[model samples]
Target chain A: DVKVTQSSRYLVKRTGEKVFLECVQDMDHENMFWYRQDPGLGLRLIYFSYDVKMKEKGDIPEGYSVSREKKERFSLILESASTNQTSMYLCASSRPLAGAASSSNEKLFFGSGTQLSVL
Target chain B: AQKVTQAQTEISVVEKEDVTLDCVYGTRDTTYYLFWYKQPPSGELVFLIRRNSFDEQNEISGRYSWNFQKSTSSFNFTITASQVVDSAVYFCALRNTGGFKTIFGAGTRLFVKA
Candidate 1:
């Protein structure tokens, strides 16, 4: 079975503090993503990386940044955490779909998630 | 623009009852994918099903089923004989064939009472 491990299950940080949420997938997937979940907004993508050192901004990337220094590790960084940035953060990984014949079948395997609370 | 709407915010049902979760989507791309994900109290999003735009077949897996209709731009999920373990927040999502981003709906919380 594929395992996507998140560094922390629960975290609490003060406002203006720098925070890091780490994720590592054992499946060697080429695609990794960061998403934040809120009450009424659902899961909004913050950033994604298709390859090491490559990143793409998602729909809600304004308050977040991501780093993919290694193939298996993707980290979401909050430069200055704020109260509004508090939410459940999820990390997911998937096989590359660009050249696949049936790309629609490519689904993501997610980590347990990190519940971050900024006070 | 691509969007997914799950209008039913929450639903409650007794055990053995049936329930349906509604989903509506809007997108400009001719080729797209629709998905259903279940998030229980564990907080991990589990992929339930994925359907392409061309396929309108209604699928059933055990007591869980999905209905996809391109003409109505809706992909609905139904649970037959609801159980207490079926309680979760279900999200409907959409992704274009050429893009990497998958937009998700607000989600529907289902509670099954024993």
Candidate 2:
């Protein structure tokens, strides 16, 4: 079984506060991702990391950033939290499939998620 | 860029009834991957199935089955004799071979009534 641990299950922050959501995975997955889930909107990718210290912006990367200091840990940073930014945050990691194209086997193992509320 | 669209916003089914969730995707890459995920009220995503571009075979697992059509670019999920436990918001997703970008549909919320 793979475990993707999130730092907090629920968090409340004031508007304009900088927020950090941490994620760690026991599996040695080469790919890590951050997503924000909202009602009707589904899940939107915020950022992802394929290796330590490497990060790529997803579709909705505006006003958000990420850091992957260690292979097992990836962090999503909200530079200035706003009411619109409050949503359920998800973290996922996946081990690349051997003998195939890297993204061909994207069976993602996901964290429990962090529900952030910016008032 | 890859995009996924789940047209049905919500579906309600009585116990023992079968329901199908539709997913349509748009992508230029010939070798992309499609996926279905179930998000329960607990707010965690459960990976259901993954299909690559080359595999067009329909798959069945217990009461859950998936229909992947390359021509329509549609990956639909069906639940047979759905139970109350199967109620959740289902999402359709797409990821290309290049990685970095995994797009998701708006999701269809399912409610199974007993």
Candidate 3:
């Protein structure tokens, strides 16, 4: 079974505080993503890493930063937490199918998610 | 740019009734992937189905079926005889041609009444 684990399930932080959300996947997938999910906005990507030390900005990357030092772990960082930045954070991993194989990159394994509240 | 849309924000249905969640996508690439994911109250995402662009054929698993139309760029999911346990937030996602990242819709919340 594939397992994606988040460092925290629920977190509360004060405004202007720096926060870190950690994610780890045991599936050894090459691609890792960070997304924030809001009530009506659904899931919007913040950042993604194709390989170790390689990162790309997604739709909602402002006020957020990501670190992928290792292939199995990806970390999402909030430089200065604010009320507007509070949302459910999700992490997912998948293998790129292009040039690889058809069956390898079909689905993504997602983490349980971490709900963050900023006051 | 690629985008996904789920027009219905919320839907309610009686138990054992049938309901369909609509999803439309915008992508210029001819080859792509569409997916449906269920997020229950527990907040864990469960992958329900995935269909590639080449395979537009409909699929049925138990009471769940999906209709994929390339011309209209729609992938709709229908749940028949919906039970209380079937209530959740359903999201439609599109995987781009390169298969690097996936874009998700706003999601439709389903409520099943007993």
C-alpha lDDT score of every prediction, in listed order: 0.92, 0.91, 0.91
* Superposition error at A39 for model 1 (Å): 0.3
Candidate 2 iRMSD in angstroms: 1.6
| Displacement of the residue A37 alpha carbon in candidate 2, Å | 0.9
Flag clash pairs in model 3. Answer: none
The global Cα lDDT (0 to 1) of model 2 is 0.91
Colliding residue pairs in candidate 1 = none
Instruction: Encode model 1's per-residue lDDT on A1-119: one tens digit a residue.
Output: 88999999999999999999999999988889999999999999999988899999998898788999999999999999999998999999888666774334478889999999999
| Docking quality (DockQ) of candidate 2 | 0.69
For residue B27, model 3's alpha carbon misses the true position, in angstroms, by 1.2
Across the candidates, what are chain A's individual TM-scores?
0.94, 0.96, 0.93
TM-score of 3: 0.95
> What's the CA error at residue A66 for candidate 2, in Å?
1.3
**Top candidate (TM-score):** 1
Instruction: State which candidate has the highest DockQ.
Output: 2
RMSD of each: 1.4, 1.2, 1.8
DockQ of each: 0.62, 0.69, 0.55
lDDT of 2 by residue, B43-87 (tens): 788999989999999999999999999999899999999999999
Clashing pairs in 2: none
B13-59 per-residue lDDT for model 1 (tens digits) = 99999999999999998999999999999999999999999888899
